[model samples]
Every structure is written in C-alpha cells, then in structure tokens.
Target: MHAWESIQASVDYIEEHLNEDLQIETLANVASLSPFYFQRLFNRLVNKTVFDYIKMRKLSKTSEILKSGNSRIVDIAMEYGFSSHSNFTRAFKETFGLTPEQYRTEPVVLNHFVKPDLILNYVMVNENVPLVTDGMVLEIFRRRLEQPRVFAGIEGEIPIEQLMGGETTGVAAGAKLWENFHKIKPRIPNLLPDGNELGALYLGNAKEGNCIYMAGAEIIPGTTAPGYQTFEMPACEYLVCGFEAENISQLYGDAVFKADKFMNRWLKQHQIRTAAFGVEMYYPPSQDAAYLEHWSIPEVDS
Candidate 1:
C-alpha cells in the first residue's frame, strides 16, 4: 500500500482503540513494519510521531465533547479511550494547562478550543525592554504593508550549543539583511497583493517610543510581487508614531543620555517577532494614526 493508505489505516486503528494500552510497537505492527522503521516513516510522512498524533487527536476530540457541557468528564474520557478518569484528566490538564471542567465552563473557549486558529495562540514577550506591564494591550492587526529590504541573521529550531544560535543568522553582523530575509519566511501570507496579513499581532500599547520595527514583518504577506520578489507586509494603516527618537535601538531609555531625550511614555509590551522586517515610524500622535514622525524601525513577524 502507499504511504497515505498506510497512514489512513493506522489512524483508523488508533481512533478505534484510544483507551486501550497503545504503543509504538502495536501501531508499528498494525502498519506491518518493525517499530524503528515504522517510527521513522510516520515522522517523515506525518510530520509527527505516532504517539503525538494519537494523543493530540484524542485530546482534540475530547475537548469538543467537553465543550458541550452535557457529558461527564469520565464519560468523555472513556469515549476517547483513556484508561481511567484520573489519567484522562491528567492528560487534558497538561495539554491545555486547564482542567476539562474549567475549560468547558467558559462557553466561547470551549466552543473554539479545537479550532486551529483559536487553539494555537502565540505568546509574544520582549522581556529585555524596560516598560510598564500594566497598560499594554495586544491587538490583532490585519492589513497589507509595502515590503522593504532589510538585514539580519536567522535562528533555527535547534540547540544553541550546536552552532551560532542554531542555524544561520538570517541577518549576519554585516550581511545585507534583506539577502536572508526569505530565510525567516512569514508564518502565513495574504492572498491578494492588497490582502491583509493573517494578522498584525500587537505586543501592547505603544510606550513612550521604544518601538522596534523591522521590514521583513511579514515575509511576502502581500499578493505575489511577481518579478519584484514579493515580501510579507500587513495591509493596514499603523497607529503611526506619537513617540519620537533618533537611534532605533535607543528608542527605549537605556542610557542617561537617552533617558533625558526619551519621549514621555512608551508602551512596553511584548514585540510580535512574526511580522516582516519593518521600520518603526515614530512621532507623537496628534489625532489617530497620524504622527510627527520620529525614527523609523524595521519589523518582523513573531
């Protein structure tokens, strides 16, 4: 059978026996292979191990039943193949950080828990920058932005001890940043050139002015630029700068000199690292998105 056929067969077997004593050996046998070979093939074809796929699928289905608030936790657990109520509860808590009961009580949350966009919430925080934590607001930005060139290194999903922060620096010390911009591809791209990005996630309210913007905010967020080489950009009007600054890094008051020149306030929230390489257009806002313009900062997606 083809790989897809094998995968479908294995998945069927798993869904039917979730509560039973499950293991790699059992599924490998079901897939008609040795455990080592089975595990490797599963990972290569499914982008997940057999163990993870089964667990996630079960938990997702259980979450749906729980949201209905009609079934008892034990019943829901059993239906999904958990060995015991305690075991089911433990797994649910670990996966969601909240108990089944607690999650179901929130009507909207329970309804949306299984939804991909709803479930995969991104947590962004820029701890190094000095700013107040209380008044920050994280907003969802959906807009198209003009793509620009930038310089920076890239980081990969690996151990830092292995190399220079894992993979190549998307932006090297002096490597023209835009050269490697495509390396850090956008998490998602917009459809039309004028289409908005998946979202322009806000870290928080703009502080006095320490906003850091990079150009590669969305890696090709707009409609394909075709020959021009499209780059990601959220199509939306930014709450342009109401804060002013000279140097981009020093937007925050780190040194005594910067402190003296610092704007009155800077919204010190977490930075969304997923946006494209963007430039911060700083200025004190007179009304809405308009501003006097201080310094430009490039941005990227979180």
Candidate 2:
C-alpha cells in the first residue's frame, strides 16, 4: 500500500479500537512500519503525536456521547480508556476549557477533533470519473453561469484563525450567521425555494486576518429584503469541487475542510486564477444530492 493509504489504514484502526487500548506497536503493525518510523510519519502527516491524537479523539468522542445521551461521566471516561474520572475531567478541561459535567449541562457547540481523511489530499480525478473511497465521493468540474446570481442574507466577519483552525470553542461564527439567516429567510420574498444556500467567504482584512462570511439563498433579481445584505456572483465559468459523505455529520468539519484543501491544490496545480472570494453551496441531504459544492470563479483574462 502507498504511504497515504498506510497512514489512513492506521487511522481507521484507531477509530475502530478507540474504546480499547491502542498501542503504538499495534498501530505501527497496522501501517506495516516500524514504531519509530510510524510515529514520525503520523506526526508529520497529522501534526499531532500518536498519543495526543488518540487522547484528543477520545475526548472528542466523549463530548459527543455526553451531548447525545444521559450517561454517567465516569462510565463514558472509562469506556474511552481514561483511568479515572478526575483524569478525564482534567484532560477535558485542558482540551475544551470545560468539565464534562458543565458541557453536558449547557451544551455549546464544541469544535470536536474530526478524524482526518488524508486521501482527499492525494486524489485528483476528472469530473466525468468521480473518485470513491471509504464512503466519500469527490468530483471536480467546471460550470458556467449565463447570468449573475444574487443572494439575500446576513453577513458576519470571522477570524481567519478560527475559520481555518478546524476547531471552535462554541457555535462557529459562520454557523451562527447561518442560523440567523434561516430565521429571517421566511420574511425574505422572491427566494427560490428550490435554490441552494450559498455561503461566500471573502478576505475582510489582511492585517487583521479576518474574512467576511455571508449566508443566504438565491433570490430573484430586483428582489429586496429589508435589513439584508445582497451578494452577486457575476456570470462566469467556475471551477467546482464537490464531495459527498455517507454520514451527514461529516459534512461539517471533515468533508468541507478536505474538499477546500483539495480544491485549492487542484487550482494551484492547474495554474488557475480565481476570484478573491470562495463560495460554498449547500444542498439538502439526499442519496442523490451532494451535500456541499465548493465553487471558485476562474479569473477571466482581460
């Protein structure tokens, strides 16, 4: 197997055996590498030590379980191989800045560490032939818009660090903005019910390292909504990268992050110039539907 596949295999093994004792020797064996080499490769690829990755993944899983059901904290901790409740509490606080009990009492959106799908970084296939691996399907294609598309929604500025960090303390700024947009969407007129939601992220301040994020649905031209911001995408050909996940929950962190990375790499490899902003188009979940489409407008040479 290739290096990426080997690492991915070890990662999959870690996920399956998260509730059990995961030993370095065993994981290395899964990757068919020596423990020392495995450790180095894992750290280089994942940016985390093996031990840290496992601990963080366990804590992240514990957080999900804490929110989903009424289970004792100690039980959850023990299940994930924590030696005791105090140890678990200490680690949870250090990682998430909250005790398990506190998080369960008033659950705020915690940016849980998602399992990495490294294959997205390596695969680049034609649009006509999508790449499928481990329940993920990725497609890249070019699309043209005959006319400008307008969106009506609310806009918010998000820190570039938080947006790219892949983890957040509470409800993500973009998510909160989307919630607000949905709440006011009913009042917006001339919205196409069948249209997909669009989230556009543009550079807001280079020195400040912030980006402006807008969330809304497409609206008919000339449609006006009070107290709403309108964004327009000019008629142009776009390089679209899309992916589908078997588990809808993966759509948020794991899938979107990987897809964005893939799209950026693909553009760079092709020497493609794109507009300043990036667009994320969200579609309703269905067997036939792609949960998200990452759109980039190729710059037209003047």
Q: Highest lDDT, which number?
A: 2
What C-alpha lDDT does candidate 2 achieve relative to the native structure? 0.82
> Which number leads on TM-score?
2
**Cα deviation of 66 in candidate 2 (Å)?**
1.1
The TM-scores of all predictions, comma-separated, are: 0.37, 0.91
- Give, for candidate 2, the lowest lDDT window spanning 10 residues: 163-172
Per-residue lDDT of 1-302 in model 1, one digit per residue for the tens?
76545655566677678656688888888888788988887766555677777777678677767776598889888877788999988888776567777777753221111111100112332322333211222222233335442222232122221112111111122112222444543432432333222111122332432222222332222234322223232344432222233333223211111221222122234332223222333233233222122222325444
Counted clashes in each candidate structure? 75, 0
| Candidate models: Cα lDDT each | 0.41, 0.82
**Candidate 1 — worst ten consecutive residues by lDDT sum?**
111-120
